[model samples]
Target chain A: MIDQPARARDFGQSRPHAGENPPFLLTTSSPGRSQRRLAVCVLVVLVGALVVTAPFARIPLENTEALLPAYAAAVFVNEVITASLLLALFSVQRSRAVFALSIGYLFSGVMVIPWALTFPGVFESLGLPDAGLQSTAAIATLRRLGFPIFVLAYALLEDSGSSARVSHGSARSVILAGVAGVVAIACGSTWLIVTSDDALPGFMKDTRNVAAPWQYVPATAVCLYLVGLCVLWIRPRSVLNLWLMVVLCTLLIEIVILSYLSAGLRLSLGWWAGRLYGLLSASLVLLVLLSEKTTLYARLVRSVSAERRAREARLTAMEALSASIAHEVNQPLASMVTNADAGLRWLGRQSPNVDEARAALKRIVDDGHRAAKVIEGITTMFKKGAQERVSVNMNRLIEETLRRCRDEARLGRISVQAELDADLPPVMGSPVQLQQVISNLVANAIDAMTAVAGRKRVICIRSARRNSDAILVSVEDSGTGLDPKYRDRIFEPFFTTRSDGMGMGLMFCQSVIEAHGGRLWVTDNEPHGAIFHFTLPSADDPPSTAGATVR
Target chain B: MVMSDDSLIAVVDDDESAREAVAGLVRSLGFLAAEFGSAADFLASDQRSRTACLIADVRMPGVTGPELYSHLMASGTPIPTVLITAYAREAARDRALKSGIRCYLAKPLDPDELLACIRSAIGDGKGRIE
Candidate 1:
């Protein structure tokens, strides 16, 4: 049926390498040049900030007692949101590395509340369990130590190739276990620190300065962060790895400023800047993930709309093709009906005209045969697979198509000239399909020249050996050239410039050529008009009688 | 105005088989039938003046059935035309009727209807031959 073309809709799955394939941007995709450059730019900016702030690191500012609680609140919000987003990604990807990092963020975010409550002055009204000064410092050391350790774990597991081994049902359980473990560890560490404050070392000196030994904790964290950075750099880098390196740079800068450069002062300029870097580190991956997901969403919408347009085009082509089929088949059926009536009328006469009746019956039989031929042609057009292939001489095929189109050319005032290479090899394909392709091209050429006046309308068809193994055929028209913008779109189904055109002609030609393992394209003819060219692979061995003379 | 047994009825169609079939049917009814491949062919022949009635395929390559009919009427040599179309649409039939076409018939045409249409086209009730 003519409607079968619509049912066999090509959803753009065939041409994977034709510049229309969707881009992969998640952790699975390696970082491209632009992402690498952007990461480098961020590194330069962060390092530049550190260099500028180093000289003023020792200057002490007045402590706003409210600042610690507020900073902790902001960090809590940033880390929790970042953790939730990562977890959401983990659920989709089922990646162990992402799960570890998300749990690390969750641990840090949850620990901040208790750390701030025990800090001393601002949250004293809450009567929180405060173990003098060491309480806050202990929680800070745990969070700093836990975060980099998780990063180290992430770097180790990222390329383990076990990400997809976790089934969907197990992914939920794993996520739950990770969240519960982080919460339990946070609570236990907080309970152990506040209860055993007497056994803890004094890392803070009179609430304004940190003792020298306290720097060892951040220094140890720095070492872990550096190791994680080395592991990530050694592994194949994805967009996630690229941004994580930037986040790690910020972490390195923050630790250096807070521990080494601030001269042990709690509210110094380096300390304040270090806190801001902490917030920046938490937000970087979150921001990148959000933007990448947005781009992925946009690409999805575009592809879906493109598929919808292709579907609609196939439907329209089907409708147009069936209408033409109806018109064609009805012609013979009408003739047959009239002939049968005439046959009966002749037989029914008072003086029966037997000879005339016999002629009418013969015409009816001929009409029936014509109708059957019409149906056979239609069926051959659609039955693309399992068709018998034979060695076909290209020049012979071209001559036959031109002969068939003779009346059309004469009516349209178009002169068709054939330029054949007499020594061309035979190509392997269904002869009927190849003939249809040539006929369609010739018809289109005539249609293109229908509007021309002053200039001569000439269609030049050429057949030659393209290479040792391929035969190339070109149909050129000396009419108005095709629009440059419509070069690719013209081959798309149901895309037509002609008002009365069904728009299936070029699409049919392209599909046929492609099915025969050939390529079809158009180029501008010299001075004026367009030339359509197609190439077919020559058969392995031509049959003994396959060579047909070229005219 | 009764149509005689020898009244020439012209059948024009692009399809040779359909043209011949219609001409065969007309001849069996005792009318003299002339078959043409197109309206242009019919017009080029002397049958244009002698044709008592015209049966033309509605759609053709160069000039359509309705267009040829209008051209003849405009030239002051009006011939009653019955249009047959495989690609029938209601709007086209209505427009052809409004333009003074004698009859519009769809493909796989009912022969009885065609005979009556031809009878009415040449001269209504008195046009039928004994």
Candidate 2:
């Protein structure tokens, strides 16, 4: 449905004038931000490398744990440094929540500080008769440091822009899926976990002859579920961080399945499953964490494309703009010059009674400047843009756009009318840009009335400062009314009835009005032509103070 | 201060604005300023008497200042004429002299230049421009 209509040929229905596109590229400053991020990433990698590469590592293996002295000295350093580097990168874009969490992670790594102060006789109290304390400390390093680092990554994901882009499951959906999958895995794995023992053609089952059920069933089921999940959620740009989830669920699937079947088997499946699940889930989490860079790279490319298109459109509009202004303003400029020249020549004669000529000359000079100002205004109209929100006079902008539309009204033999509300307050946005929006609407109203034979050729423009943070400008014409269903399509570019003319006038008006942090739409006019309505920011929006953006 | 057959008027313009502003000026001047948005709007408008005067813009829509004078000869609007222009180049001035316009006026115009020509026009029989 969407594909067929958009491709149809129609006058005025062309690609959007560049304004609708993203703004163009930044000048030389984009690289500065990239370089800073790169430096930080490299610093993190180097710190992590130094800690892991240090020789001799120790880990405590259970309460019966002992670690070699040299090993304790090595792996403890590796874990702490890796944890610290991750903690630093997490602080760049900060929030109170992230700040508090990173502090907790930092202190946990700080907790590893006291490991350096171990006394010589600690091995006896640690209950390691033969094994060294280094062995016990070995597992301590990962449990203490690795878990906190994972939590930090979770915090980063929650606060980033990519939060929306990442795949998400509702709390209820997750719980439902969890319970259902667990039961299904249990049934599916039961047969796999236990090998059937048959004797004498199903005469009787013998428990004494059968092996203990604590065998391969649970571990094998979990491994299979792991492989299934990997295939399900592994598409790029689908679910972020799902690979880790696939790993975690794989462990549970194996354990539950094995527990059911192990009743008929004879091995410690739980212990084996637990060991493998921990290693694999941790590996998957780290691998996903590394994928964050590519996602950011993709977003940057999208941002660049949006910018380039907007700039090109603006450039095309500007080239023809200068000539239009000169044509519009030349007459007034000529009259001003004529009056001024007459006065100057009169003064040069140095006549005794020159007061009459002097006054005429002065009026001409003043008139010349006034004429110049209007020309200046018409030419500078081409320079309009910049999205600084600010307070503006709603009534003033409406009256001015109405005044400019007088020429159009005269040419079309349309009578223009106004019902302005004096009590209207200031609205926010660029006054000139806002004027363009109003003019475009008023122009459209006049155009719609061109074919109407004789009911009424009146175009009504009204403005008000009511409604929250909004000022309204409405243009109503008496012409062929649009069907109610087609109202929404009117704002879409290239949607117009005029055969030779571009239908962009209203669409451009809509975009301009919208960009001001406002709204635009069409509705039924009073028993006649369609009404083009829009809002501007109210007085509460505040006045703008920035210079124009140079494209 | 109404116009008479013995009185001659001149108009100088190339666009619609020129027609309007000049008509307003001519009305103020107590003579007729027959307007032409172009030489075409002018030639299309009626003219009478060789005794009338012409005030032609140096650059016209069609029918150059010299050409306007040449066309006037056959039509007999035969009033002495003045040439007025924004770009008062030497070529246009020489053309006006050769074509029999008594004076060529530069733009950013002086009402005095026009008034003086009108006074001279009132007296001359052949509409000779001073």
Candidate 3:
């Protein structure tokens, strides 16, 4: 957790757009090109497989007694994982549609346990109370019918742009209620099917032969699956909707193979194929959700890092601006303090020289006004500044920034050369911000050269017309050439080579250039150091009178 | 208090009000006060030899206070110097002190501190003010 006081301070000072909407959820996000293609391809493959095996579906195969238990175990595990993941997503998204879908999966997964326990051959040897012959088929039919109904509920509720968000405290209760409801329904269905076993229509004439009415059960399930698929297809499809449609299609194929095409033969090729289809249907949505979560995680990491760098760059610009303003105000304040002390000294004198005392007092009053003027200038410059954009001559701006660096250049024994185009058109920007951009670049150039001893430290600044609409300025320093390893990372905040460096200078410069509708980049200055280049779009109209007065 | 007649204290700063106020304080202490707007102006002035103590702002447009002090020492006319600045960069201050500047002070200068620095700068024995 972030510290409260620090977060409160940063609330207004930084992160102006922190309250923006979070990354898109799968339920709301439209399927992308690759995702849509993959979903369609999977549906085509399932349909092709079913058609190829349809004629041979009824041919009986050797019965493996373990297959039923194993199939049930796999379905149970797959459904539970899928349902829990969907519910977890619902907890975060608080979307009612996702909650409905998850509850459906939960009910289907829980029904498998009772269906497996009551199958005639499996439990006969255990000496337990024999389950009715109809119990297994009844539970299996109910589970299949239950899933498509939930999907229909999900589709009906999936309105675009309207999130049915429950309040925070109620979200937990809502989730609990959905879970309890699924459990209650599964238990109620199992109890009713087991108690009324003899009264229910026989699904099998014997252990190996199907009854006449069993065809109606699979047909009804197939109809429900089609309705779910149709409703989902009618809605504007999101990633979640697209995958859910795939799930419904697989269920339709499973039902047709199990009863309609199997020709009343139990443990046939068609029956095994139908069970495999059921497992496939259970795994499809879970796989897509897992992969989507991974992709979203990667995107989140990149965006967070980018945001942190931008914030640091802003902090650096603020530091430089505040430092300069403080220096300006302090000069006048210092003068006033000295003047007041002088006035007091004059009055304390033995002769009490009235004229000298009065003159000293007058200077104090003047210094006080000067200090107030400094504050007033700042108020106009920043608080109400409006970041007044104007057409600025790049040559003059570069000259001013370099002049500010004159002392540092002299101390470092670096020589500066300017080859500016005299006819370069003015570009529109805030003069102070543009000044900062150039100063930061020039300062970085000087720093890059400070360690050089054998070669002369030189910085060449050039400005030229890049095209009709743009002007380019390059600061090339003959210090150490840009490190090949760090070339890309140098512009990142807090990526400094020097111990004393804050590593904010270049990042700040890049941001300022970008904000002014320009681009900044760095390249190796041939045979020696790095060349930093920036281009600004030229203003179409002639420079305004107010613009000419900025510098 | 009165300083020796031969003592001249030169005050140099890019800021007009700061220069005048520092000069005014020196004058009130009974020493001859010379004010210059920039280090370049002070360097071109004819009062370099006559000046007993130099009070200059560390940061200036053309030439800075510490630069002027170093230039004077190199030119064999090392005036006792006290460096002052509104923006007191620690690195610049340390460098100035190590180079034998008489004193290094941040702005909003205390009257007593300035007097003490000036007294020691001009050799306490020859230009003492009491």
Candidate 4:
């Protein structure tokens, strides 16, 4: 019985996951993400060189004093795009990694405006109150420091596969806190720079003071963190993690270049290159994430279609089963009605034929029980409940299944021959499900033989002890043999040869057999036709008995 | 209104218990009953001309009730058939009625309804014979 929720979960389970089925060679690398990372690396290198060469080579391009506004606008656009992309990624899958990354981007995008406003010349020229170069340096330092910290946190969360997600209310609070913190830092730094510009150290006064001892502190700390992150990357993880590590590596190189170019004036080519590298690092993960999102969407579409097809096939199978159920139930009902009438007639005689009436009443009782059993069988077979495994006599179950198919066999001019080992042991399984397996096989055999002319139609069912621990049952039909090409695909769900066939019968049989810790397979019978064989562990087996005993 | 026991009603059904039970009811109604496992068996038997009414299941192995009715009609021996079915298909009932079947009844058949159909079928047969 397949419940809707349970089957939906099964569909989710069918999706391939990295940790679920690990590769034989445990490597944390992905070629696609690696290629994207390489592209990012090349872009960073080209931009880094261009920025570094501009000041020393005395290019026609103006210095930081003139190009400041254009640089600020470019940084603003990059930051905004990065933040939006991160938020989009967070929306798709609310992981700690994405949340942290989004917050980092948001902070950087907001801080860039304040950083540009206080960068000495640009906003001061417009008569806007500027926080001076000290606040500009502080904002730049804070922005650069913010990204790596968030990225490292994201990497840590990725390492812990089941990272905790923030609740809705808490997440909103966290975002509010982050915005307040960024605003506070920006305002506080401006206030300090405005009130005490002369009290600040020489390193904060200008971009050319790279030799200041305080400047090395944040750079060394960032380098140490980057090294630690590199160590984490040495171990195997997902493709996403690997790409993030690559981004971090490039960011580290950009940091080194930024510190080196800090010896030059503001908006020096190296400083601009450093900013470009930062933009590249931020964009790398977003690009990979967007590509992954596309792949996931494609997978989702494929699975949904596959699920729909499976459902359609199941409906078709149910229709066939319902027809069979109607026939099975109706026979006994007709018998019961007839017997009741017979009993009444016998009793209505002038000299009541009591013996005959008693016989008719007995038949009525038997037919009533038969009808009830048929209803019970169908209910149990189709019920959306967990299957209950019990010790079931295989021979008896096969006999009952054959009895159900007797009418079909007769109509098809098919002879059914059952050879049962008298001493065969019972197996543990759902009797109704097992019975369905046999009935489907027998019914299929009967249907297969309908096309045969002149040749004797014979269906042979055999049950024997495969060993002390297992019992084997086989159904063989003397009909058109299975084609070699279709033999492998016969058990695939919805793969059908007949126009009227739903093609789920064999697949259902195989699943039931496998769920019972058994194996079901097909083979070519001698001369003609096909044989389906399944093996069930004997009830005497300790493992199988354990399951039934628990019930 | 009295009918002799020699006036036989043939009950053809794939089910043994149903065939025997219907036969028993016919016997109690002052008619001799002949039971056949299937329509083919009834056709093979020598009781076709003597049978006053034919009560047969709609679905049978070799020949269905309506098919037997048609065969009889084609042979110039139109037996009054009351077709019994487990599945109450309106199309089958319509087809059976159009082919001049006396009645079409679904299974878990009402004994009273069946007896009435059987009596009416016998009356029709007798009228035709006279």
Candidate 5:
């Protein structure tokens, strides 16, 4: 038993917390150079692989004279350039594992280069008798060295952000499994290599002509099958995992063709598996490259979206500042205007108006006191507003919002109205935030009415019961109908249709409502303008979250 | 500002053009007007004790309309206020009407309708006739 959420853990602790997110928001303009260089390096690897596999299509291992030189040359070139790229990356940043891998890669890249360069003739220079040089030991050395090239490539990938942390497996377990699988595959490959060269296994056959390299076809097929099973066990969803399995299956089928070549003492052509094997390997490498590119593209897209959201919040704050200021300043200003008007009237009247003049003076004095009081109220509110969250009444919230805009509505000749939902329950929320939302809806309605030339300029605001679940308030304006296409996106920040409006209004409204555990939306009222409505969730729900504590 | 019947309303505002305009609009419909220059004099006057509908300007220099409304509201004067402000704030309006404002009007207040709202909030001026 794994004693863990075995299947769930397979997705790991979300994504691996690694340097996968670069240290800084890097805007490196030089990516063009690096990307092109990487692309060229990839092209070189594929070309070298092709050139190396080509000549080997002609001869069996026993006929080494025909193929070794070119194979060595191709391997050497591919390894060297790959090593250079890794080394360049290492020099740019000392990201631990990459540096270590580069050390090994650079060494291997150099050794393979000389080996591929001196190809076919290098086998002749082995200084052993020709037949002895074709011994299984000779072939086994090449197999061991050739296999590590792929292992090294996997190392490079791990260094590039594909940390195994995302897979929930212990590092020790993965390493052990990889090692065991590689050893098993290597042993099977060794059998296929030795048998295909037609060297008889003393225990399996008597008087057998093992000179036929193609005779081991069934054994080679079995070896390829093992490689497929191991890759599938390691990573089911990885493209590399799927491609490696498919390639091995293809190689297994080609092994059947080897049977005929071996039987004809066409030991001269029995090395056919080598050419087929090289092609399948190269194709898998290409698939891995493509999958990596796609993963990079997805991660880039995710970061871009996060950046956009942060930008939008700041924009919304800027757009709603005016309404916020009005809500604060409107109260006292209205009071002063009323007191002044009353006082001014008493100044000119007849009937000696003695009592009336005195009364007006008293109101004037009262207006001054009220104005000072409102200013004090606003000063306290702004200074402490940023300090903490407080519970606010939805009913008073509506009134204050309307009063804030009282002057504006008066100036526009449009009527402002309100009907408080008598039974509305209190909701805990940010007052400023809720104010911003209601103001946006009201302002938009006022703007819409500006274009109309009719006397039906009533803005009916009604607050009503919304069943037992919510408190609903709707602002019904008598402006023209809104465009249908603009419906869903009206709440998208900075995406406004108005030339003078900061597109942030609707979006900010939606955000504020959402923050308060409520919903805000707009609709066309029957026969006329827009009806914007919002609902704040009741504060009576029993806490389902772990952190809730009743006061 | 509103007064229970027999008590006259003095709606003093500065925009004489707007004040008399509003006065004519209100008086033609029926309401009293005792105008003055600033709050300084209104504090020094006699009507402070017995006056009725106080339709004052919110932006007056010495004392604002809301300042007068709050003072009266705080004193438990039993007078209903029909505050008219050009403010677009929810908090302030809510505070003004928490007890029960006849109506919180935004100016330029509709002269005829505001009087009607004031009359309705306190009971038609005739209610005091009983």
Candidate 6:
């Protein structure tokens, strides 16, 4: 059994976005060319700005120590904000990319404070014991390298389908355990480096003191990572992958500025520019992820309102259906009651007329059965289950439909004509549904002619073999023709010209025809009116047979 | 009540059972009855002149009961008419009354009510003749 309420709630919670865009906002596959162009344009602008500002950036500052707290605060704020946003995204849709990204942010945030404190000038200025330049370089290297590696891992794991294997409950627990483990590692590593600065290699210490020779190692590593990221960026599999490429690109620019162009002293223009770029790179993925979450929430609200409107339409349809049933059943019942009463009057005579009474009694039985048959047709039509299809004679079905609407046609002063081809093959479809289609068409034709003055109120219905595999049916009316603009929209649900019309009649007819593997449409009638046409495939033909040749 | 042999009661209805049943009820009340499948058929017959009290269905093929009554009044032969309907619409009843119909009854009509209506129409015919 399907859990309808739960499914509805899920729609309310995680509704899919409408229109051409997918719920994963940035995962568009076809926009790679444009995105590449945008990347080039941004790269050009950044390079030009750097070249123009290099002369002014060469001047050294009076005190680099004054800027250390501000730089540390900016890094801390960016990393923490990014981490929280990634965590929120992972909670919404548990994925390997989101989990790795969140942990990476947490690591960067935790390591940045220690990196700031252990920097040579900042540490001595704060009057704390100096954890030498080597320790600070190691921590800075780890923090810078952590994000790109995690991002690359996320991009490579796009099609791994790791998220599908984990259940919702297990995924939540895994994320929590991963978060705790990262915190422990970050704190433990920071403490080890701060307490015993000698654990670092002598070469790392020598490189930190000179800063020129050993910088090439990290610079070369960043360039190689940039090349790898560019290759992956060419054909990003998801939104996260694309944004990750942008983050990595910005990180490469920051690394080039800090390790290649900047002087050993603090507060250089290259240093400030590199830090600003790093802050931007850290926030890009989180911004994209958070925006996607907001779009998903907006989609949820739209879907809930759409469902509520659908429910209201269904209730209105039910009311209309009941009214139709009452109208149909009342005629036969009236005859039954009158026949029974007439039968009694005949039998109560002084000289009892037995033969006449028998005739009246027989009519009562017939009328009762007729009413029962009407009820049976209604119940079968509305029955909620798989519909049964069988070979049906189009001519007989049309005749029956006309018979049902004969009284209304006559009362409306409408002359109905039928031209059914005798040699036409039977079509495969549900009899009741097809009957309703014809009945509705005929009724509409009569309604359309109700207001016509000084014109022949005629409704012509015809059925013929359109091809070897299909048969065509048409209902033509000599009434006011539909506007050419509304010709197509007339079949849409809740679209109607009549004030009293429920507007579901044509929509229901179209659906019934479509369900029978056919097509329904309308055209302008000759002279002045409208004609509705539909086609059904022959029973002997396969479902994939060529469509009927009818304009 | 004995209706005059010369006075014919015309029954107009589209349904075979309903038309015959109403005719049978008219005959049971001792009136000479004639049946017409449609208002057009009744209008074409010579029985229109002889009909002292006409019992017709409100809805029928070609010409409805109220329309037939209007046609008769327009032609200056206003016969006393009783309208019977299977579907009871207040608008139709009001239209029939406005057209000067003697009675408008909904089906399964009470036999006594119909009999009383026909008897009074016959009585009025006699009074008008005198």
**Fraction of native Cα contacts kept in each candidate?**
0.92, 0.12, 0.85, 0.60, 0.04, 0.46
Off by over 4 Å in 4: A1-60, A63-102, A124-126, A156-172, A193-195, A204-225, A253-265, A268-271, A349-351, A372-551, B4-6, B126-130
Q: For residues A448-495, could you state the per-residue lDDT of candidate 5 as single tens digits?
A: 888877546657666665767567879888887689998888888668
lDDT of 1 at A166: 42
lDDT (Cα atoms) of all candidates against the true structure: 0.80, 0.49, 0.80, 0.70, 0.52, 0.73
Q: For residue A298, what is the lDDT in candidate 2? A: 76
TM-score of 6: 0.61
Model 5 Cα shift for residue B7 (angstroms) = 24
Each model's number of backbone clashes?
A: 0, 41, 0, 2, 86, 0
Give me the runs in candidate 1 sitting further than 4 Å from their true place: A1-23, A162-164, A348-354, A385-551, B1-5, B124-130
Q: Cα deviation of A452 in candidate 2 (Å)? A: 61
Error of 1 at A444 (Å): 36
Question: TM-scores, in order shown?
Answer: 0.70, 0.34, 0.70, 0.63, 0.33, 0.61
lDDT per residue for candidate 3 within A285-373, as digits (tens), equals 99998999998889889998898788778768868887888777777778888888888888899888789889988988887887788
Could you tell me which 10 consecutive residues in candidate 1 chain B have the lowest summed lDDT?
B121-130
CAPRI accuracy category, model 2:
incorrect
Candidates' RMSD to native: 17.5, 21.4, 19.8, 17.8, 22.6, 18.1
Enumerate residue pairs that collide in model 3. none
Tell me the interface RMSD of every candidate, in Å: 1.2, 5.2, 1.0, 1.9, 7.0, 1.7
- Deviating ranges (above 4 Å) for candidate 5: A1-221, A230-235, A250-273, A291-299, A302-551, B1-130
- In terms of docking quality, model 6 is acceptable
Span of ten consecutive residues with least summed lDDT in model 5 chain A: A21-30
> Scoring each candidate complex against the real one, what DockQ results?
0.59, 0.08, 0.54, 0.37, 0.04, 0.35
Worst 10 residues of 6 chain A by lDDT: A7-16
